[model samples]
Target: MLPDFRLTDRTVPSAIEVYGIQGNAQYVARKAEKQALYAREGAPCVEWIPPDDLASVQLPPAA
Candidate 1:
């Protein structure tokens, strides 16, 4: 799957996902699947649920 932002420079696999849609059930399911895939691959991710979780989402330090 294509991530919203792929952190290619990180020492380990990493990505940033911007979850802009929350009202649709299919989109929500896909989001969960993607998150699970990333976790299973041992990649660090920053998920930004805009208008709410932006401040809470902490990005990983630069490599």
Candidate 2:
């Protein structure tokens, strides 16, 4: 199954308009074909940065 990409009319003023909530629970279930799934098991929530940081975040050099 393909990953779900949520889109709105929101336009981000960045070089690339990459956007969305990634890999939600439903997405995982679908991708796993309803089989037993595993995430971080007992991991804590990730402390994500603010949205604006995404615009300026530098990507790794292309391989």
Which candidate number would show the highest lDDT if scored against the true structure? 1
The segments of candidate 2 whose C-alpha lies over 4 angstroms from its true place after superposition are: 1-48
Indicate which candidate wins on TM-score: 1
| lDDT for each residue of candidate 1 in 1-63, tens digit (9 for 90 to 100) | 889998877666578899999799999999999999988988788888877756787767667
Give the Å shift of residue 24 in candidate 1: 0.1
Inter-residue clash pairs, candidate 1: none
Q: What ranges in model 1 sit over 4 Å off?
A: none
Q: Worst 10-residue stretch by lDDT in candidate 1?
A: 53-62
Candidate 2, which ten residues in sequence have the lowest lDDT sum?
8-17
Output candidate 1 Cα RMSD: 1.6
lDDT of 2: 0.32
Q: lDDT values of the candidates?
A: 0.84, 0.32
* 5 Cα displacement, candidate 1 (Å): 0.7
